[model samples]
Target: MDEMTCPKCGSSMTSRTLGAVTVNRCPSCSGVFLDRADLADLVEAENDWHRHTGPLTEPLPRITADMTAPPPSRPKARSYIETLFD
Candidate 1:
């Protein structure tokens, strides 16, 4: 197939194949061109991945006030020379 030009930026697009699907991506603008078939294939692949990795059983820990609080600043230790002067 001929190399595609990005419709958004008019930049030269590179062809990348994921499994049997071929997608045109613009290096300049990071835009991807996907037809219906390509989109369907990608969606199917994502569904398969989700199916293999089961949903999380436990809820993730929520951020609390303590967790968000800034850590207490410690006093700077005096250097050996400063201590000798003291």
Candidate 2:
């Protein structure tokens, strides 16, 4: 294991290797440490997992017409016979 200083607090960080990548974490600040390669690998894995699982689904809310508005003041439309006479 390699040792590094925390950038935020300058505290000693502990290093550990998981698989092929190395990670460092600060005990005092509870911060995670990762190299550029480690972050890229993590992002790629996350994207792949999301692709296989498909997109997430969300429920839509139901809508109803309002009944409180006043009715139309104009008269209803005339039939074809009534219109021919007029």
Candidate 3:
């Protein structure tokens, strides 16, 4: 297969489709290349989505366990709770 060079990172670009448009995408740099019509279509679609979206919408925050939070202190002795409760 023919390979296309990524303009940003010099990596190989692969073809990816969004809706009806085919765009050249660079996996390494996460870049998308589109022609004039393709860009226009993307912008129009984005605007349409924003226009129809509710004003109260807020971007969700990424949820991750706090690594700095000390790991659960292992019980110094086997708890009787597990044996009795079981």
Highest lDDT model number? 1
| RMSD after CA superposition, every candidate | 19.4, 24.6, 18.6
How far off is model 2, as Cα RMSD?
24.6
- TM-score to true structure, per model: 0.60, 0.49, 0.52
What's the best-to-worst order under lDDT? 1, 3, 2
Cα lDDT of model 1 by residue, 1-86, tens digit = 77689999999998767676777778899887879998887777766665666545998678876776568996542331122112
Backbone clashes for every candidate come to 0, 0, 0
Clashes of 2: 0
Residue-level lDDT tens digits of model 2 in 20-61 = 556677989978878899878666665655566555588954
Q: After superposition, how far is residue 76 of candidate 2 from its true place, in Å?
A: 62
Which tens-of-lDDT digit does each residue in 1-86 have in candidate 3?
48888888999988866576567778899787878997787667666666665557789666678635557985532332122112
Which of the numbered candidates is closest to the native, going by highest TM-score?
Answer: 1
Better of 1 and 3 by TM-score: 1
lDDT of each: 0.69, 0.65, 0.66
Model 1 TM-score, all chains together: 0.60
lDDT of 2 at 33: 77
